[model samples]
Target: MRLFLPLVITFICGIVMILHFFIPHRPISTIGDGLTDWYMIVASAAIFLGAANLVQVHVHRINTKARNWKYSPVVLIGFIAMMATGLLWGVEETLPFDYMFQTMIVPMGATMFSLLAFFVASAAFRAFRASNWRATLLLASAFIVMLGRVPIGGMIWKQIPIISEWMMQVPNMAGQRAVMIGAALGVVATSLRMIFGIERSYLGGAD
Candidate 1:
């Protein structure tokens, strides 16, 4: 009964959404809009559930004194502090919430990204090694693109920038479009499977 009901609901909602895109009739459109409103309410409730789950997990870890449990308090403290500030002072500009976000959160985010740059450089170095013809071509393309972005590459060879631009506009764009098309097809397939009750994995057991 549990799985059957959800599958029925999924089929109905999926058909309504598909019709909403194609038909645009008054009755279908009204039902689609109502479904969308219900989706928003469910999503809002899920956010609260997720927050509660996070707090519960961290509190359990702190209470059990699990490995690296000391860090859990930091997560809890940050979550509580942000919530308190936003609820008490509001998130408007020049308020405590905004001040903390700009001064503390933004800098921390920047620092994390700065640290990630080194990891990316390390990965790029490994990936750019000319172990094969394909790797050699990749290394060369990367070298040209990197150099083209700098002043020295133009000073050394004016054509470097032009080649880099062509590579990005031609091959890179083609690859991106291919990926997007594949992803769109995959989404369509998955949605159809779910609508027809063939994708039973969502019910908890194997499909």
Candidate 2:
């Protein structure tokens, strides 16, 4: 019964959603839109569940006087400060809470992305290793494209920009379109299998 119910619902819901793309009737179209909006609302509620879980795990460690209990107070305080600010003020504008979040959260998020610069540089170095003809060609193309995008490269070699643009528009776009088509087919296949109960990874591991 646990497995049976979800499969039935998935089949019904996926079919209804796909049909909505073609159906033009106002009532059916509205039902489709309403269901999609309800999905977003449901997702919003789950955000609380995630926050509750975080507090539960961290608070338990703090209560038990775990090794890093010192950090828990900071976490709790930060949470409370933001919550108080947002609850008292509003998210629509530069309320104190929103401002704090914008300044602090945005920079921290940006720093996280900045961390990727190092990894990408490292990966590019590793990815360019010329072990084979194909690898050598790819590395050469990547170097040309990267340099072509920069002003120094344009000054050094005026022809690279044209070469890179042709590669990007022709071969790269063709490969991207092929991959997208394959991905679409793969998604449809997986969804259909799930709807038919052929896939059950959602159910936990064996007992």
Candidate 3:
């Protein structure tokens, strides 16, 4: 009964959503909007549950003196501090919440991304090994793109920028469109499977 009820509900909801796109009658559109509201409420509750679960696990780890448990307190403290700041001071520009976000979080995120750039460069070096024809092509393309973006490229050869722009506009766009079409097809297949009850994996155990 438990599994059957959810599957039926999911199938009905999926069918309704699919029909809602094609049928724009006032009542049907209102119902679709209501369903979206319900979805948002459920999503918010799920997020709250996840946050609670995170806190519970971290607290348990700290209590049990698990490996690397010293970091758990920091996590708890940061979470609590953020929540308190938002709730008490509000998120106004002059408030502590905004100050903390702007000063600490923003700078930390920037630092993290700056560090990741070096890691990306290292990975790129490893990936750009010209062992085969395809790899050589990829390496050459990457070199051109990088050089094309710089002032030195124009100094060396004015045509580099034009070549880079053409490569990006033509090949890159074609690749992106192919990926989008493939993803759309995959989504359609998965949705049809769920709507027809052929996919019951979401009901917990395999069907």
* Number of the top lDDT candidate: 1
lDDT of 2 by residue, 1-207 (tens): 777777788777877787789996887688789889989999999999989987897899899999989998888888888888888886766689879988999899999999999999999888899999999999999988888888887798899888888888899999999999999999999888776677777765122
Cα misplacement distance, residue 111 of candidate 1 (Å):
1.5
Extract clashing residue pairs from model 2.
none
| Candidates sorted by TM-score, best first | 3, 1, 2
TM-score of 2: 0.86
* Cα error, candidate 3, residue 22 (Å): 1.8
- What is the per-residue lDDT of model 1 for residues 1-207, given as tens digits with 9 covering 90 to 100? 878889999999999999999888899999999999999999999999999999999999999999999999999999999999999989999999999999999999999989998999999999999999999999999999989889898999999889888889999999999999999999999999999999989887467
Error of 1 at 119 (Å): 2.0
Give me the overall lDDT of model 2. 0.86
List TM-score per model, in order: 0.91, 0.86, 0.92
Candidate 1: give the clashing pairs. none
Q: Judging by TM-score against the true structure, name the best candidate.
A: 3
List the candidates ranked by lDDT, beginning with the highest: 1, 3, 2
Q: Which stretches of candidate 3 lie over 4 Å from their true place?
A: none
lDDT (10s digit) by residue, model 3, range 1-207:
877788788888998888789999977788888899999999998998998998999999999999999999999999899899999989989799999999999999999989998999899998899999999999999999888999998788999988888889999889999999999999999999888888888777376
